[model samples]
Target: MGAFGVALILGLNALVGYDLLHQREETLARAREDSAAMALVLEQHATDSLSGVAKILAGVVEVLAVRADAWERGDADVFALLRRQATLSPLIRAILVVSADGKLIHDTQTLEPAGIDLSDRDYLMAHRDRLVPGGANAVFVGNPVRGRTSNTWFISMSRRLEAPDGRFAGVLVAVMEPMAFRSFYQTLPLSGDAVVTLYHADGPVIARFPDHDSHIGLSAHHLPLFTTLLKQARAGTELLDSAGDGPRRILSYRASAEMPLAVTVSSSRDAVLVPWWSKAMTLAVADLAGTLVLAAMTLALLCEAGRRERAMADLQDSERALRDSQQRLIQDIAARHRIEAELIAAKQVSDAANRAKTQFLANMSHELRTPLNAVIGFAEALESGIFGQMSAKQTEYVGDIRKSGQHLLSLINDILDTTKIESGKYVLHQEDLPVDDLIGECLRQMGPLAVEKGVTLTAALPGSLPILHADARAVRQILLNLLSNAVKFTPPGGRIVVEADRVARSLRLRVSDTGIGIPAIELDQVMEPFHQVDNSHTRRYAGTGLGLPLVKSLVELQDGRFVLSSVLGRGTTATVLFPPSRLRNRSEPLRALKRAQPAPV
Candidate 1:
């Protein structure tokens, strides 16, 4: 009986110890998974945000490619463009154009050049000295520096601006503040001592959640993450011991493939082990109680060998206590499983909400367009004197009604078109289209607008050009939107040129206008639906801000690439390149070609 009691005590301790170890491992594994998932989310956010900055820098360079001189001349329109671009992203503190000599040509915050010389800046010197690889379009990210204009900390992203002759023109730069990243990180669902951090590939901390301002811009190159881990892999997870007696941390990191950025998520090991600790404590208490009961029963059995009934009753009581401990242990495990199930269900709900929002947008756009069309038709009839206009004042009022209605209708149409394209409901009606006729008809349609604006509009087409196999109405709309935008933005004496030619087997249609050009930083953003270069409430231009986006969509629907470039205070060029696939071969039978048809909206 004594030996049996000793063995029971030993077996119970071993079993509970093993269970505790297993639970500890399970908790740590869960912590690592959560950290890794968060790291991936942070990495994607950093990549997308930085990629946007790169595109803005490239756009600025492209816009100034033709008229780099305007940047040097301190054009007010150029400054306005810069301001507009800066407003597009809260992360961007300023947009600047620096001449070849490193003098500030224009900055978004000031109407006139700041006259600051940034020749010594590493980012500027890198481009000037041709140290940056990847030609003119490559973006160079610089270490964090205090902004001279805003007196705030910011990192610079810059690209080299080259003239048409391929000479170094200037450096176009966008300054990004880290606060935006920190703000974004705060919105993430992190608990306890968990933290998210954004780091430059060079090892400086760009932003951190929980708002560690002093740590910003500090280098962590000596850390294992940079010295050994990152050197081995672009992404990974590891357990790190803290300095002194602090708890260890489990960190997971991911590096961006598109930019010089990395993100990390770290969770305190103590916090992760909390559930395991509770389970271990309960098990320890149960084991101690069972061991005491077993020892008492063993002693009673030995001392009361003569009293068999009494010894049997004591053993039954010990067995009942052991059964209760086992039941409690099972309940603990069941509770943990229930918590995990709840977490999974919560994630499912979040995903469903996102899908519902997208569907709502599509449905709302359709509902708005139906009544809007009717409003425009009634306004048009009233303007045409069908409602019996009596006086000059009444005529002007009717004209205003029609104009406002048209503008609202245009906005609704753009919204509907965007939704259709996004939902994959937009279809193209392909046909063999005459390049000359398409340009001519579009010009004719836009001639009145150009004349009203007192702007010169002309087309330069080669004597012979291949036919474009595309949706005729889509092509026509693309051309008209480009021309209309040119006319609307161009000054009274400005010139707008429409040129078409063949590059190998592809067709390139370019619309160049001597208008208030777009800021380089806004080039990519302007391609997105309803995004305008000038988005201020009191902006000089009027439209739905959908023309370029619509044109881009239509061009791409036919498998073409659309490129936009502009020079501040000089002009903008919208180029649509149709691939060899979309260019009709002269040898193909025109008789079997489908007639030009309009695509359903």
Candidate 2:
């Protein structure tokens, strides 16, 4: 992190360290005292055993001297050598002697090194006239000097015996390795890192224990403890500080009681520091985790509270809008009722006007028909030459007068039909009539005019045709009018066909003629009252133009329909379609006419 964070962490660790320091005392001195005491106990035991070894070697010399005599007597020395080697005594293992005269003496263990010279050896030279520690007679044990070489590291003591004339004699000696003393000192209770170092006051070491074996002839680590011992030469109790391959160790050390040496007690730092850091980090992580969880829970609660407040405001707005809409709907219903009443009154007035129109048409038709009858009758008789023979010019003028009268008659009839439709008085008396006979009658009436013009007027009636159901008078009038118009317009030597047949559902009545045909634009107009193809053509064809209109009205009255098809100067067909009910009614047998007129002619 940052420098401040580093400093704070160190501060906290120091606080923990300071707390532990106050709880336990620092015991460098007490450790030194205990370790030194234990080392002294082992050293005392080693010194005692060294004294005993000197005494045993003194006896070893006597046994060797006795075994030599046994050899001189030619007796076995084996039993005496066995007694000396049999016991693994804490002091001595073998005993022998060497002479200052440079010759080896025999003993129980001397058979292998016989006749060897010893006067020049260190055992003989160093103790030529000294008294030995074995009560003034100890000899070096296991020493090669004096003809014995078994002692690995030890000193020997010997004394010279003078002749009666005070002459110098050979040395007597003792040998010891000091290994027993070293093993005892190393096994005493001490810290695992402790070291017991033994060195000569001079440069080279005489011997050492604590087999930190590499330090046998070297100085210990150059630590505070070692520096104090070297600089001040103070050998009292003190704390040791050292670093090594094992661990950073704390030590307590003091000089040994009677040896030029020191004993150190040390403990590794791992034994104290590891658990302290573990506890500190455990507490730190637990606190951080608890704080984060609480923060997240608080954020969730605030978000939920905000959502509820917004919902309540929206609900209030919707409730106010609903009440306003209900008030507007009530006012709309009241306005609608008033408009409906006005429409009812207006409908009644329109209906009365239409009835008046029907009445006026019926009355005027009668009036016009009566006067036309007089005019047409008078003009016809005159044209007949009934008032005496007249000039050709007069006959022609009278013919025109008669045609105009008949035309006016046709106009009045159409007006009467329209009035019936307006008044809704049109009725049908449907009955059966033979379709084939019906065509025959229509052709019979129109045949003479066709024959006079030399047009081939004929009926194409199919024998298998059905009876037709319609008002007999109305159906007859429709066909008669169509046939008459066909014959009147057709050119001389042309043809006319009155065809009656059943085609699909309707009974087809087609009146076709080779006539002065209608032009496409004028075809629809001819069906309207007073509308003709053209004025010049109208005067030439001799019709009031109401004939087709009257036929259409009568055909529709029987629930039939009329259609006219024409091509200019070619021909025309007038077809009436009477639906199936009419055809079936015709097939029924008919009784004698209740009311009959002369057959249509």
Candidate 3:
């Protein structure tokens, strides 16, 4: 019977796992189909958008062909025709008329110089050097480029302007802003991590939703997604790492029917599987509960059968032995009952404590924030001299009051955050975030603090680093707290360094300070909430002692590790390590910034 029970349980477990797996696959398949549909829609929209510009360009070409003499005479009506075309198309940034020799004759935006040369432009060069066979009205879509006149990224579309004698006259070009395409993408019902990108066949990204200005004209040659699309058929779907932020995603792309541009739409695996995982977990828990109940029933039946067998043996032998067996069985049963009762009581107590803790934290958060907010607001008003200021002493007093209020507000906010984390009310909004950007911003914000404290600060970030899949706000807070503490403790002439390096399958960020170092014995205690090394009411530093504890909580929430090491008289180094699972390679290029050296206080 026991063997049969074990076999049944194993079979059920396998069946449940297989069903969940199947459901998850089905969900992913649906997401892929959705992404493909979205890609097709985007492609059509892009075609229509470009086709509209092409029509406007075609109109200008015909007008110029019919009125070549008017153009030569600098006819206001001809220039007005060009301006009208640009006005009709809001997406068109500018319209330029370049002579056959590549010299600009007229610009819809300005008429400063008729001799300005645009021969160096790709669209001009393409139109001047080569002609499409048997297609005189063909529109050439140039690569995404920055125009010297506008100094903004645009997609240039040009049509060959012809003379009445059928010879080429000049190139009539219309520059379209990438933001026009981005606006269309924003209207799509895409997940937060879902990305919609429009890129040229060769490499440059024309427009992308969730865009970075720097990536508008950046090269995407290193991306497998683009390279694979270039090799494969015009339209297809595949699982690939996102070329923008390195999350694994299901990407569907379709090349434009008219242009050399491709529209790619991607949905992140995490977003697609979120609802499926929730349902799967629920079913899994239910299955586990049922399995436990079955096992318990099986054990009870087995025990009863053993008890009956013992009774039969005792009855056939002696009464005394039967009585002894009965007493031992009773005692064992009573002990088991007592242990079960204790377990039930302990569980009840734990549940009650948890509820109480959650309630207390919530109440304290609301109550404290309300009054602290008022205090800070009033103090700010006084410091700003909204109420007329009197003497120097009065101004100084107001400044002190404002500073104290601000400090108190900060402490209150930290306490609320820590309480939320401890009570399990804190949630992380995880996404692909550029750690380098966050690091740079943190250093900038902490710069003034570091200088005021007479501490030299430096940062050495790699030219390239993997983007972190984490809560950006939490990660920023962690860095700010660490850097703030470093600045606070380090004395005059002391140096603080913030650097990041890749280790094995993880990334490590270290913040080291030449501060009054912590004692080795208090290292573990320092991470405890509200437990400072100098646990005195009149401590030199102003803090609530929740910085390290809060940092540790935030790091662990993202499945990362935080470690602190210090010597008695030396400095402290705080290291935050993120596992490989939490680190993703970035698809987009980053602007190179120089490594910072220690700045004198």
The candidate scoring highest on lDDT is 3
Per-candidate TM vs. native? 0.52, 0.36, 0.49
Evaluate model 2: give its TM-score.
0.36
lDDT string for model 1 (212-317, tens) is 5877888888877788888899998999874411458898989998888988888889888887888788778767766766666678677775454564575578
Q: Which rank order by lDDT, best down to worst?
A: 3, 1, 2
Report the CA-based lDDT of candidate 3 relative to the real structure.
0.80
Per-residue lDDT of 21 in model 3:
95
**What global local distance difference test value does model 1 have?**
0.79
lDDT of 1 at 69: 49
Candidate 3 residue-wise lDDT, 1-601, digit = tens: 7887687778878999999999999999999999999989989988888889999998887777776443552344465567779987768987888888877776777634356567788877776666543367788888888777567788898998767787777788897889988887888789888888888877788999886476788878788756666577888888877646667889898888687788888888888999999888866875685466446545645776665454445434554555687799899999999999999999999999988876786688679878877877887787787888767888788778877876776777788888888777898887777777778888988998788878998888888888788887899899999998998888889999999989755889999998888988989999998888973422778787899999999998887889999976679999998877777777744333323543332
Candidate order (TM-score): 1, 3, 2
lDDT of 2 by residue, 1-601 (tens): 2354345445655665565554323343344466556545544554455446545545544554444342231123432343344243443333334455745443334344366567666555545544233433534322211124552444343333333364443433333334544575566655554555433222222234555344434444455555565346434444434554245544444443333334444454444334544544543453343333333333434566565455445546655765787789887987788778778878887888777777987999988899899999999999998889989999999989997888678668767866776567877676667666666666676666667778897777665777666777777778878877887888788888878776555688898888888888887788887677775664666555778888888887786779989987889989888766566543457642232332433
Residue 358 Cα positional deviation in candidate 3, in Å, after optimal superposition: 56
TM-score, model 3 to reference: 0.49
Q: Indicate which candidate wins on TM-score.
A: 1
Flag regions of model 3 displaced more than 4 Å. Answer: 68-75, 111-115, 131-134, 303-601
Q: Which parts of model 1 have CA positions greater than 4 angstroms off?
A: 67-69, 72-74, 242-247, 300-601
Which model is ahead, 1 or 3, in terms of lDDT?
A: 3
